[model samples]
Target: MTDGKVKARLKWACRRGMLELDVLFIPFVNEAYDDLSEQDKLTFERLLTCQDPELFAWFMGHEACEDTELNAMVQFILGRVKV
Candidate 1:
């Protein structure tokens, strides 16, 4: 897909129904996604496909990802928000 289309799709996917997930995801998509390596970009897309409760657990630091790729992506997103 074109970069514009990819971004638009990502923006739509990032809108999790839950406020907490939305708050975390939308900012990262807007501010950081374009700078990620191609692999990381794909990983982030995969992360978005995961169920919301699972995502919430990871982002809340209450659960950990067994997949290293996903673990790293979660950390990458967390890093951006940790001022």
Candidate 2:
């Protein structure tokens, strides 16, 4: 797929039931997603598959993601937003 298509799909996937997640994800996909390596991009996609509550915990620093890759991605996003 084209890069725009990929980003468009990712932007859609970034939308969540939670507003907190939306603020984090939409901006990340818009401002940062293009800069990611292919591997990291895939990892981001994998992160999207995760449940919202788990993602919330991870993002909020209340819990850690057991998957190192996912954790890294989570941290990376948090770091970017300083949240």
- The parts of candidate 1 lying over 4 Å away from their true place are none
Local distance difference test scores for all models: 0.93, 0.95
How accurate locally is residue 20 in candidate 1, as Cα lDDT from 0 to 100?
94
* Model 2 lowest lDDT segment of ten: 74-83
Clashes of each: 0, 0
lDDT tens string, model 1, 1-83? 89999999999999997999999999998999999999999999999999999999999999999899999999988888997
Model 2 gets an lDDT of 0.95
Q: What is the lDDT of candidate 1?
A: 0.93
Look at candidate 1 and tell me the lDDT of residue 16: 91
Candidate 2 C-alpha lDDT tens digits along 1-68: 99889888999999999999999999999999989999999999999999999999999989999999
